[model samples]
Target: MLDEVTFDIERGKIREFVLATHAGDTVHTSVEAARDAGFPDVPATATHVVVAGHYRDQRAFVAKLGLAYDRVVVGSVKWTYFRPLCAGDSVRGVRRVAADTRKRNLRFVTLETDYLDAAGDCAVRVREVLIERGAQ
Candidate 1:
């Protein structure tokens, strides 16, 4: 893994993210609604895991990877969920470079991050593709 960081999943954060993203799902904001939906508590939306970045210094990571910070852009993202991430969950995200290659005039870097729950089980896997422009 290239780096790792752990953070708590708070109810308020989940609610705010739900509202900000217009998820239109009460289960993401209301514990009671989530309970009714068979969840232990308000569950975070899939993309909410992106908040993990706030816990780390991404610029340092980019520098460590030798990637041009100004030229790097997110190309795509994929998420695989193994279990629901709830409001009180504390997850540790482990990041690694899955692939790196140059095609034509662009450099493509594939990064994979696995969010592991408190029990050490992977709750989600995020695959992100970053493209660096003018890297040829």
Candidate 2:
């Protein structure tokens, strides 16, 4: 099964994230700076912001798949950026099960998340591997 969710990339949120992360990059925090840098608007948000959103969308699906919270651990995460996600862009995340494997008492599931921009163009792809311990 696949799970999907959409999120709006608001300017305020981007600025707040920039401040919280101490990014010190004006382009990410100010529209004027981004425009000066040749961007149409504020530059793309920090990668972690999109990553957090992706995980938020995936949490419920993981639980629905019968994976207990305590038993599960993150194995790895990889992100590939195709294009910048500017402020005011609406992005959608589509997550699907990629692989499932069992090794002894451990079970591993790989999830692929495709992030699409407002124009429906793929902007980023994330692959996350999760491990469930003591699971056959």
Candidate 3:
């Protein structure tokens, strides 16, 4: 497992992320809508936004491991959300190397990341496979 990377869930960033992705969830952008939905604050962030950050953090770790980006492609991502992550929450992700296998001319690296909330509770788990072409 690699060191954890942390991020703050800012309301403005969440709103912008939803807008950029056209998530179509008003609760992600409007506090009023979230409150009307009975949330104490803005509801959980759009799932893709959280996953994107997790992917980015893992990519940085892969880079630090001296992996060349030009030969890498994302294979798959599976996400499990345990609970809602409201605005102002702090999220930290830790990456674990799940498996590495070579098939023909490609290498598949599978990784899992656990996203922890401010109270150190697991909020989400993401499993991703990255294919490295031309890997030995």
Best by TM-score: 1
Worst 10 residues of 2 by lDDT: 46-55
TM per prediction: 0.96, 0.85, 0.83
The residue-by-residue lDDT of candidate 3 on 18-119, one tens digit each, is 777777878887888889987666855546435445436555776865567888989998888888777878788887888888899888888888888878
Which residue pairs collide in model 3, if any?
none
lDDT of 1 at 96: 98
Candidate 1 TM-score, C-alpha based? 0.96
Ranking by TM-score: 1, 2, 3
Show the colliding residue pairs in model 2: none
Q: What is the C-alpha RMSD of each candidate to the true structure, in Å?
A: 1.1, 2.5, 2.8
What RMSD does model 2 have? 2.5
Runs of candidate 3 exceeding 4 Å displacement: 48-60, 63-66
Compose the digit string of candidate 1's lDDT tens values, residues 76-127.
Answer: 9999999989988999999999999999888899999999999999999999
Worst 10 residues of 3 by lDDT: 46-55
Which has the better lDDT: candidate 2, or candidate 3?
A: 2
Clashes (N, CA, C under 3 Å) per candidate: 0, 0, 0
Better of 1 and 3 by TM-score: 1
Q: Which has the higher lDDT value, candidate number 1 or candidate number 3? A: 1
